[model samples]
Target: MSTSDPRPALFDQWLPAEYRRRGDFTVLVVLVGIDTRSIELLSSTFMNVIGDETRWREVRQLFQSSETDWNGAAFFPVDSVIGPVPNDMARTQLRALEEKVRADRRVLNGGHFFDRKGRRLKVEEIVH
Candidate 1:
């Protein structure tokens, strides 16, 4: 998506000033084709691979997750209001998890990640 994508507006439904004051940034990352169970377990899987639950947990605590049913398929709408991570650290971790999960073509086959502005970014955007 371009910088003007309106979808990014949904990224921050309610980012509290207190969070931002602490350098926390609210973000939205969308993943499709994953069951609700996998979505719930995603955090654990992520931490397992990175071995930095402290950094991950700091962001994970503010997670707000939901699922969308469209045409009988499920889409995960995951967002977090945690940040202050230096240099887009959360986005990097999220992209890593997205690619790793989809690599095996298992439960999570595909999805897209977006920045806080709702701008859709390619996996490469964050991977490199």
Candidate 2:
């Protein structure tokens, strides 16, 4: 996907093999966008991966509108959340959540998360 594409493409590196058998997983998504200088986080959400289709649709709609310029998103499985928090807190929480998921053995080697246009974004492109 191009940087100007409003529809964000999804990526995940640690999806487990038994995801389909285990059903939906809860996650905290970090939306990203690229400007002239760097890739930046645009928004965050605490939601279920499969059950929150409406919410994901809303996010895409928002991106299509004039309100946002996001082009990509990454999802991380999180155990819980205390409602909306600041972006700084969300980033910190994401790290902790990743460790938790890793410890729980919920993450595995090669699995697909979700992709909008079948474009896999490079880590260097997303991480500033």
Candidate 3:
């Protein structure tokens, strides 16, 4: 790994042998925003696969800064963090979760999704 690479260094140090040898894996996460009245789903993505430094930095800032707001809402992680799943499996899981969220009318802000190589993708591109 390059010293300035945006992928988290901790994963390089701690990832299991199988995944480490393969170099990258997909992890799906859901972020939620909460106010006095409601907790709404903010975004869902394989954020760990993002390799763009600027975008990664922005995401890191949001994840670390509690007061950051998105569309007048303060977002935070919910209980759902899935994977280190294989690439194909991650897509399947993401599709299923997107369906459930759509059905529930819970998605607030849209999300970023990426392939193992850090290429941005549309939900339709990934799911089908």
Candidate 4:
């Protein structure tokens, strides 16, 4: 998508300060698609293939991770809030969520989550 594309717009335009407070930056990178080699070239010419390759590896590791530091873990939406999804199922569940979003805007409003304490919370914005 172009920078002008509305679906996956720039981070600052969409994410709120609350989301950036902890600063793990993995989810940010993923949402921004910064690890994609083509997007990296489009985003900046100063960064070369080495940087992109490194980031690609890092991004892959994060997705393969079962657990991460608080900041990384914090990026994960609570399952009950989103569904009965287990933490290990994050990748598959997220793909489904993305597909649902593409199929219907109502799913954006439909998704919800529950915290460890069982508090109900809606997935207000994918990044918020």
Best by TM-score: 2
Q: Where does model 2 exceed 4 Å of error?
A: 1-21, 50-59, 62-66, 79-118, 125-128
Worst 10 residues of 4 by lDDT: 39-48
Q: How do all models score by TM-score? A: 0.24, 0.44, 0.33, 0.24
Q: Which stretches of candidate 3 lie above 4 Å from their native place?
A: 1-26, 47-59, 62-83, 101-128
lDDT of each: 0.33, 0.46, 0.41, 0.29
Best candidate, lDDT: 2
Residue 96, model 1: lDDT of 64
* Candidate order, lDDT descending: 2, 3, 1, 4
Expressed as tens digits, the lDDT of each residue in 1-128 for candidate 2 is 35774333442222332233345555565555645555555555554445333444554564457455667555655443443355566568766645553453223111222333324454322344
> Model 2, clash count?
0
Per-residue alpha-carbon lDDT of model 3 for 1-128, expressed as tens digits? 34664433332232333244343445455544445454455665553442222343345455546543432221112222442455566667766775665565334233333222333322221232
lDDT of 4 by residue, 1-128 (tens): 22553322222222233233322222211121222121111110011111112322343354446242211111233223332344345555555655554454334323222222222222332442
Q: Is candidate 1 or candidate 2 better by TM-score?
A: 2
Off by over 4 Å in 1: 1-28, 33-82, 104-128
Clash totals for all candidate models: 3, 0, 0, 6
